[model samples]
Target: MSLLHAELRLILRSRLAAASLALLMALSALSVVSGLSAVSRQEATIARATAEQARDLAAVAKAYGKPDGEAGYAAYYSFLLTHDRPSPLAFLALGQRDVQPTVLRVRALSLQQQLYESETLNAEQALPGVFDFAFVAIYLAPLVVIALTHDLVTSEREAGRLRLLLSMPGTGLWRRRIGLRYLLVALSLLIPAGVALVATSAPAHLGLGILTVPAVYLAFWFGLSLLVASRVRASATAAAASVGYWIALTLLIPTLANAAITRAVPVSKGIDLTLAQREIVHHGWDIPKAATFDRFLATHPEWRGHETFEGRFHWKWLFAMHQVGDEAVAPQVAAYRASLLSRERWTARLGWLLPNVAAQGILHRLADTNLVAQLDYQDSIGAFHKELRAFFYPYLFFDRPFTRADFDWLPSYSARTGTASWPAIPMLMLLVVTGLILAAGAAQMRRTGRDASR
Candidate 1:
């Protein structure tokens, strides 16, 4: 305890170390605040959009909600709003949420066309990305660790205490100092994050995982810094090497890996699918109504021979035509989704070797902001669209009028809860890598001690 206290005093007495610790703590806290604010804004946007959607629905109801109202027109004009609300822990890592649309209004038409409509976003603001807790943990925290530990041994040598410290009999001296520094660095990052999680009432187990990630990630950085420090005799050289390593691992390597993944797997199939759906729907206008119904009935045999309207503009036939258009591009849709999943799989595989990407994958998956989360949201929307088509088919096929009461019976979208999950394999690989690095650092420190003793 006395030794630990003396070391703490020594760290505090050093202006650079103390300032680095203070700055890291402040940055962590500020990131939490910034994340919370961004999440609050997203919540507010959803609430506001929901209210506006309600107003729009009411307007549609006012125009078309009557016992004598045409079911076809109501189904055509009434737009149902579906949204993907942010997860409870989303503030920590915004991920792909910034570019993806959370609120979308879909009509009882070809869902493939509506699902692919892009949302308008500010390129300038989104280019920099969100400054959240994950950013601090993955990008900034390592630099702080490097600053604190890069000179651990070299500084002792410069102060003429290296030989004296080595002469001490115990193998625990360097361990104690390194361990203390690790704890302080971990606390500096985790304290703010822990407080934010508690304040947000984030899931208990998820919060625990969030806390564990930083401890392990920082440990990896510390271990790497220790390895650099042990071999370099001068503090300046050790710091330089550590910083260089930080640049390569966090910035250069990840960027190159991302580029490689993009080249290896092309996701432009999404655009092709969208274009195919559009072309099919456009061509549907020139096809005979009976031909469209025949194709629709092939899949929806339940509604076969029931919707025999002779009018040129029957709502039942119009919807059936749109459904046929969606069905026409089913193969393309499957290919597009497979391509996207392929990209996600490649990213997960890369996480095994790159800690930055691994941390990102874990954090985004936990917060439900990754590509998987976006794809899940789209799946929910697709399911809701199916339910919607089913709902209106009863009215359209039976030729029953859509009344105000019928509007009340319209199916509302219930968000899926269990879609996103933790990537345990990637996380385990990260821990293994960190442990191996720490072991290597310990061996290097031991080797340095033996050499100095000679």
Candidate 2:
């Protein structure tokens, strides 16, 4: 206890150590605050969207609620709102939420057209990414570790205390120093994170699960720092090597990997699907209506007998044409989604090799703010769209009048339930990598202690 206390005091006495810890803590706290604010804004936007949707629905009801109102016009004009609420731990990571639309008004029209429409954003602001807790833990915190531990052995040698300390110490002298720094770095990050968990009222078990990521991540950096410090004989060389490693791991490698993954998995199928759907819908106007009905009825065979209409134009035909357009691109849609999932899978595979990527995947997965979460939200919207079609199909096909009471029957969208499960495999990889680095660091430390004792 006394030895640990002494080491802690010694670390505190260093201006660099003191300042690095203080700055790290402050940055962590600021990031948490920024994340909370971003989440609050998102919630506010959702609330406003909900209220606006209510007003819009009421207006649609008032406009189209006549006893003789045609179902086609009502379905055409009434745009129902669907939203993806932020996950409980979203503030910790933010992920792609900053750019993706949370609330969307989707109607019974061709869903392929509406699913990809997003509000324009400031490209510059989004390009840098959100400064959330995950950013601090993944990017900035390791730099602080470098600052504190890069000179762990070299500084002792410089001060002429290396032989004296190695000669007098029992075992774990290096362990004592490294352990103290690890605790300090962990506290600097986890304290703000703990506050955030409390503020957000996040589940205890889940918060702990999310917190484990940074704890393990910091250990990886510390172990690497210790390994570098033990191997390098000069403080400046150790610091430079540590910083260079940080750059390669966090910045250069990720950038290159992203380019490689994108090249390997082209997602141009999204554009192809949209264009094909548009082309099919456009051609539906010139081609015979029977051809459109044939395709539509294949999937919705329940409406086969009701396809006949007595007019040059009918609501049923229009709706069927639009549905056919969406159906025409089903294969493309699957290919597009598969391409995206392929990219995500490749990223996870890379996580095994890159700690930064692994930490990011784990945190974003826990927060439910990754590409999978976005895809899930889109799937929920698609399901709701099907319900919308079902609700209006009776009125459209049977020529039944849509009344004011019928407006109330419009299906409401239920937000997706349950959080994304903890990423077990990626996290296990992180632990294994951390263990290997720490083991290497320990071995290096033993060698250094032996060399100093001689």
Candidate 3:
């Protein structure tokens, strides 16, 4: 305990180390507060939008909610609001939430067109992304580690204390110092996150899960810093090397990997799907009712015998044409989804070599803010869309009138609880690689002690 106190005192004596610790803590706290504010704003926006949506629905009902309201016009004009609420832990990572729409209104039209509609986003705000705890942990915490550890041995040697300290110390002397520094750095990073988690009343397991990212990430940085510091005689050189490594891992490699993934697995199929659906729907207008009904009935044979229509624009035929449009582009939709999943798969595979990417992937997954989360939201929307089709199908096929009361029967969208599966293999690979780097650092530090002892 006394030795640990002495180490703390020594660290405080250095203005750079002390200021770095203070700055990191302040930044972390600020990030938590900022994240909380952003989340609150999002929730407020959703509430307002939901209220507005209700009013809009009521107006539509007032206009077309008559007892004899035609199912076709009702289905055409009435819009249902669907929302993707932010996850409880989203404040910590806010990954893709900034750009993705939280609230959307879908009509009984082409699902593909509604699915890919982009949300309105300010380019300036989105250019830099959110200033969340994940950014502090993944990018900035390492610099703090580097600042504290880069000169751990070099400064002692320069101060003419290394030889004497080595001669007088026990076997655990260096370990004690290193361990104390690591503990301090970890505390500085985790304390704000812990407080935020408690404030939000997040699940205990979730707190533990989020804490793991920083634990492993900080360990990796400390190990790399120690490994470099042990071999380098100059502190400046050590810090430079560590910063170079930081840039490569966090910036260069991820950018290059994303570009390559984009080329390797093209997602332009999403646009193609939309265009094809539009083309099919537009062409269905010119084609005969029998042809559209034929195509729709191929998949939905239950409605095969109910393919009778009287007018040039029958509700049943219109609905059938839209259904056929979606079915026609089903393969493109699958291919587009598959391509996106492929990108995520490749990104996870890259976690084997990059600790920053691995930590980011883990945190985003836990916070339910990654591509998977967005995709899950889309899936929930799709499911609700199916429910919408089913509800209206009975009314349209039988030529039953859709009244204002029937609107109550329309299924309300309950945001699905995101089931972001743990990336076990990627996380395991991260642990193994982090362990190896730490081991190497320990070995190098031990060798330094041995050489000094002689």
Winner on TM-score (2 vs 3): 2
Candidate 2 residue-wise lDDT, 54-123, digit = tens: 9988998999889999998899999988888888899999998998998999988899988876633456
- The digit string of per-residue lDDT tens for model 1 on 210-299 reads 788778888899889999999999999999999999899989998898899889887764556667877877787898877888899999
- State the C-alpha lDDT per candidate: 0.86, 0.91, 0.86
RMSD to the true structure for each prediction, in A, is 1.7, 1.4, 1.7
Over the full model, what C-alpha lDDT does candidate 3 score relative to the true structure? 0.86
Superposition-based RMSD of candidate 1 using all C-alpha atoms, in angstroms: 1.7
Residue 132 deviation, candidate 2, in Å? 0.1
Per-model TM values vs. the true structure: 0.96, 0.97, 0.96
Q: Give candidate 3 regions above 4 Å deviation.
A: 119-125
Model 1 misplaced regions, further than 4 Å? 119-125, 269-272
Q: Across residues 20-124, which tens digit of lDDT does each residue of candidate 3 receive?
A: 999999999998898888889889888998999889888888888789988878788878888888788889888988888888898887898788767333557
Count of clashing residue pairs in every prediction: 0, 0, 0
Best by TM-score: 2
Residue 278 miss distance in model 3 (angstroms): 0.8
